[model samples]
Target: MKKEKLLMTPGPTMVPPAVLMAGGEPMIHHRTPEYSQLFRELNKNLKTIFQTQNPVLTFPAAGTGGLEAAVVNFFSPGDRVLCTSIGVFGDRVATIAKAFGLNVEKLTVPLGEAVDPRIIEEKLKEQNYKGVFVTHNETSTGAYNDIEAIGKITKNKDILLIVDAVSSLGGLDLKTDEWGVDVVITASQKALMAPPGLTFLSVSNKGWEAAQNSTSPKFYWDVIKARKAMEKPSPQNPYTPAVSLLRSVNKALELIIEEGLQEVFHRHSQLAKATRAAVEALGLKLFAAPQARSNVITSIKMPEGIDGEKVKKQMAEKYGVITAGGQEDLKGKILRIGHMGYVHEGDIIQTIAALEKALIDVGYPIEKAVGIKAALEVFN
Candidate 1:
């Protein structure tokens, strides 16, 4: 029998039917009035998703490229920037800054733990930093940092707060304007429930001011040029845009708004809660602490004798439950399950059941249906 395929990874999550169909439609010419209307509306609607009044720039790039744009467009070379990291993606920010010839300082916590905002405050007090980079939700370790607190610390200062929200943008309660996030980076996939190809980011007034003062060399990744193009009466991209992907993102954003922002966030919260409950019920420990847990993806620590990679493979190849294994040193030590974007309660139920079956198949001792029962209780 052929098993059903499920996408349980943190990114490239399951796409909705409406969004898929939008991508299938015939491509519209970028210069047409119809496309210009769409291009402009997309910019406005993205502000709603980001909870910001600033223009949300759309680029034909991945989240990483958006991250790079945030760096090059806002800071000059040799500027002091602090990159606070809790996992792989956070570390990537420092690397990108170094590549741009910026003086990078990293405040990294242990894997599976969130970076403390107080520590960030202490570090800022000791040095004059041009900007502070932090991950809203660490994709690798499933840890959610306290960006709001960090934002509060950097708000009164001249420091710019840049957040990586690739995984948490739509699924989590990230208040971009209210939280004072100067710049936020996200992608079309992940919680946006659209296909990979487009990157979206918002910049506040402070972020724009920094960009004006920035002497960084930028051409294609130039936010100033992108914003100027958008400011025209008929909006257009400076380069040929990904028309189909942006079309898909329009439908996805509609779905998100129709569900209501608070409702969407609540759904992710419930799903994450159910997943954590199931993991604990199955006698497996979660890699992230409760206070630092991410609603987008849940990382579970592997049992002492079980191979996390093997379990991930069995869940996919044998049971049709696609899951992600840990990265780097944590590889073979943890397994991650995504609960973001277009996921329902039934998906959670089925995922927990599949996880149980995979565990038993991997020689891990577990009582049948215990995990599912706990998960159901949480959902109920």
Candidate 2:
């Protein structure tokens, strides 16, 4: 029999049993009234999770597709936009914008640090930008930006405040409407407690008006087309949707709602705090800055002379605890532990114990059970 392993990656986190069972159910016709009713209910719950009163649009694609959609639908070629970067995902937004012939101005901060809203405020004063792109949580470095602060800076301006909440939404508190974010993009994986395949975005009235004038070439990612299909008496996607994934997401949303959003966010916060404490007790340093740390994922720096990949490998092979390595420039230098989406106290304890053992196996000197003890103290 195959050994059971805990998935602790930044995305594609472990799914709940109910969510898995929902995905296994038999498929239904997308155009049928039954499916339409399911779709409508799903959209309503999504708005609650997003904390927005606007219509949320769903697409049959990954998180990157949502990013591309935001870029293609909001501005035309030659339009000036500000893309803020703190890690890989932040830079990805700028890459997509540049690919579409937009004049991109990148405002980047050091790795493992969150973007300072004051810099954005100062930049806005220098140029009349069409949009400002921000990543609520940078998964690579485990840095969390303050969307509320940035929103306050851009709310009254003519610029659109676009946010990539792929890893933050549903896991953190995001006031989409209250924060004045013009466009919010997220995926089904991550904190949604569902399988990958579907991506969703909530667009404000300003976003829609901007779309009307956008000349960027697009068809499959057209939000207007999606909105039209959804506006019908029987709501549906512009194209054939991911019925199984949608079913799983519906069940996942139900679980989140049942748990209560604030309680869920608190659980994530406690889990992250426990994980951070465990890492510190194990003599391992965290990668992200303290004030900017993310609750969904914790990035830890490799111990002196220890290989991050080896630590990750030993954790999975010897202990059946799967974790992720860093991306781009930080690869093999950092180990990321994800504690979001259906994760709990027991899971954190188990992972900390496994990590302690794995660190010892990889030639790092550390007392056994220290990490677990630290984590337990947090829970107690």
Candidate 3:
């Protein structure tokens, strides 16, 4: 075998060995007292990762479901909400809001660019919207938006701020409450180093207040009912939870805490820098701007006349290094490399080496080990 298959996509990233082992442990009944104790402790650990004192509700859904929860629990039908989007995942927030009968106004920047907080501020000034939605890190384009600045604009004006931190939460730095973010949606799959079954949200006092006033119809994604369930004597979900995934997620969080959040952030930053340096060294341009680049993933533009999809296939099938291609309009135009969640410096080095081989195989000119050498410089 050339290599073991590695997950280098933005989500469903490579799960840590410890988390996988935790998942293999004997299952526990969801309603039992033992599960109650474990779930409660998991909730507390999640809060630490989220950096908020709010109730971090874990739902047995993907990150998009968490996005829907924000829409239904806070705004009423026909209520105007401004959505700031830079890429595919960012656009999903507005799509979900529209599905719930809310009037969605979008402020979109070109792909590979971050949403300007100033633009968001100006838009809010012109509208009487109930809330503003934005993604902290756009997985599709590898852009990281300025949540702190956007949060200031919304909170000071008393408008609800909803953030999708799915790709940013555990890998990058996010201060949910301090930034005045009323609602934050995240998933266990990306930076949390867990499987894809679990989604999480951090709801502030403002968010709960909106829940009380929300007239939008909601059932499984009901924040109020879920909170009530947690407030029960034993504390539980209204429905069956993904007990095994939760156990694995707790182990992942424990590993994160043991490494220290700051250290983890630094590690990702270093790896991300290395990736950018290596891509440039190979004569490829970066898709996202340097200032807006995310610590989670790196999007690289295919060299002129090079076939992006073919290169991606070669990497996965022959080299055993799985990566993601760009979405929608950018499909077959660029390639994405994820270094979030359980990624190491050596993993990055190997990925770059594989890309060098794949690029050559796809008829793009590149010197062997050129990217690896440049990446090592950044790591050192």
Write down the TM-score of every candidate: 0.99, 0.99, 0.98
- Once model 1 is optimally superposed onto the true structure by TM-score, how far is the C-alpha of residue 93 displaced, in angstroms? 0.8
The window of 10 residues in a row where model 1 has the poorest summed lDDT is 1-10
> lDDT of model 2 at residue 366?
95
* Clash pairs, model 3 backbone: none
C-alpha positional error of residue 118 in candidate 1 after TM-score superposition, expressed in Å:
0.3
**Regions of candidate 2 where Cα sits further than 4 Å from its true position:** none
Candidates in order: C-alpha RMSD to true structure: 0.9, 0.8, 1.1
* Per-residue lDDT over 1-380 for candidate 3, one digit per residue giving the tens place of the 0 to 100 score: 25569899998999988999999889889889999988888988999999999999989999888998899999999999998899998788888888889999998898999988888878887878889898999988999998898888888776899999999988989999898999999999999989998899989998898899999888999988888888787889989989899999999999999999999999999999999999999999999987899999999999889878988999999888999998899989899999998999989988998899999998888899999999999988
Once fitted onto the true fold, the runs of candidate 1 whose alpha carbons sit more than 4 angstroms away are 1-4
How far residue 308's Cα lies from its native spot in candidate 3, in Å, is 0.9
Query: Per the 3 Å backbone cut-off, how many clashing residue pairs does candidate 1 have?
Result: 0
Q: After superposition, how far is residue 75 of candidate 2 from its true place, in Å?
A: 0.9
Candidate 1 structure quality by residue, lDDT tens digits, 279-373: 99999999997799999899999989999999999989877878899999999999999999989898888889889999999999999899999
